[model samples]
Target: MRTIGVLGALLLFVEFVGAQTLDSAQVSAIDKNFWKTSLPRHELQWGVGCPLLEEFIIYGMGSDDLSGDFDRPHNWFDKEVYRGSRGTTLFNWSFSYLYRVCKFLWVGADVTYIGFYDVYYDKFTHQKAYINSDQLLTFMPKIRFSYLNRKYVTLYSGISCGIGWVIHSEKKEVNVVTNWAFQATAFGVKAGTSWFGFAEVGLGYKGFGVIGLGYHFNRQNRQLFKRNSL
Candidate 1:
């Protein structure tokens, strides 16, 4: 429900927050002298890379149940049982698309996948309870409003929300678990530079906190004097 609202908002236009360093004359001067020439030959709109994303369950509830009667001490037989839902790791990767809604601001739609893997040795059985993980595919479309600063760097803030699905199933003994599916949500801030392109990290609970790193690419254009009528 909330996801839909966020998606709608992201689809709309956004404004960047920044100090008006360029006066009207300076803006016009740059518009005539620099912007028109540079913009036409800037970075390509489409780029592909391994985008780092941090995923957490903003809110989730799942439990495991065992299906067997244990009247005696020998309950650990060659049978099937359900284990409760343990927490998931919040690190993954997503492909990004900078959807330009404003000149300095662009909304990025990220498709991210995170697999929760747990491998531990049982002290009693001396066997491994392979809590094999499920992979989640998220369609996180976010809105970013940024200021391409005077120094030609980008400073931005993003707010995103999306739908999450279990693209790949968890295999217990190479079988998918018959468990209820869980969903998630996220939002964050970013800072860009020349040395490393850009660094984006943020917080939004998906049953836990999310932390991520995204490498910016195709960075070329900087000055935009004219009001982008888009």
Candidate 2:
């Protein structure tokens, strides 16, 4: 499957790319400073983006009720058919923690959830009914490459491999599908000292792009040195 290949490629890419960013001396210094001093150990992020759920749900429907005759209502008490389908990015969140392994390498794990509620109607009897919903939960152990780690700003590239489950309830039947999840690449930048804002774009289960705000609890300790001191 394409997803399987992507998962493998993402793992290899992170290792190869993270390795090429630094030498042994720089890595040693970074590791020494990390354990010898206080540094931020975790990151919590909240964001919103596209779920890309509409098409997938429609495909799963396997009928034209939701797509073709979505607006036309035939009868009630008949076989339950899709009244309509709507996709959204109203819920999305990610949490990750990184331990400095080298100047350019930070290893961590991240978990994320993206969900949306789809409203279904009963052709003629019901009006504006909200009974259908879909949710996706993913857990990824990732590796990040910090190209520039600074007090006020951070630039990084990351990759992750994980599994995701899609949960949906149709009529009275609940269907759950699990698949290989991969983040091909995520390039992002954070700006601020304590509370920061960040934006990133890449291909993944979450979406094609991500934007959010976060708070770094150990921000003060994350700064290895003052910029003015350099």
Candidate 3:
């Protein structure tokens, strides 16, 4: 009888352990499903870039005539001609917000600022003629598509169109300030877990080359497929 009782207790213990293991598996599956279906609705990012690189392109686009040496020198700054030379510096920064529409797409908006300063010299008068500083503020609505959305890195491209307002000192001015602006192409690579760093380039908004950081409101949203075993 003693032997039989010991065998029965052993059998019962084995059955209990199996049941517990089954319960744990079921719980894990449920958790996975819950996470897979839920995601964050919004994200925010900030970036900075050098806008001065595009100064020549921006100015050249506006003028119909460039008979002078301005086009020949291939120089971005310090162009000296019949008049005294002029020099410029620019900086770009932006804050953007995004709302996830689905797994791979997002629609959002951004506000970008391009700040520039110029020094002008008039050789005819042998004097510093003007010092001009201005800021261009642009508000744009953007759409983005993300690919290879993995935990470590993601690739993305986007486009934006909007209006820009030029804010300048009353004493100074710029030629061909295009109030209507459009960014037809923007592409970048991002890396991180939940908080990320990115390097991007685009044709508009500060012209090209952006580096920045972003954070996802939900940690689970970082994974491309959340339901998969982690």
Candidate achieving higher lDDT, 1 or 3: 3
Residue 133 in model 1: shift from native, Å? 0.8
lDDT of 1 by residue, 5-50 (tens): 5753453323221313433345756653453334222221221222
* Model 3 CA RMSD to the hidden true structure, in angstroms: 19.6
For residues 75-115, could you state the per-residue lDDT of candidate 3 as single tens digits? 43432323233444345787889887764567999788775
* Per-model RMSD to reference: 8.6, 6.2, 19.6
The TM-scores of all predictions, comma-separated, are 0.50, 0.68, 0.60
Q: Which candidate, 2 or 3, would have the higher lDDT against the true structure?
A: 2
Alpha-carbon deviation at 195 in model 2, angstroms: 2.3
Instruction: State the C-alpha lDDT per candidate.
Output: 0.43, 0.64, 0.63
Candidate 1's displacement at residue 25, Å, is 8.2
lDDT of 2 by residue, 1-230 (tens): 58855765676576556546544445656664553344355566666645554235425656434345455667433455455766655645665656656656778776778766677775666666556666778788888776766667877777878988777776557899987776644567778766788777666765667778877666445454554356
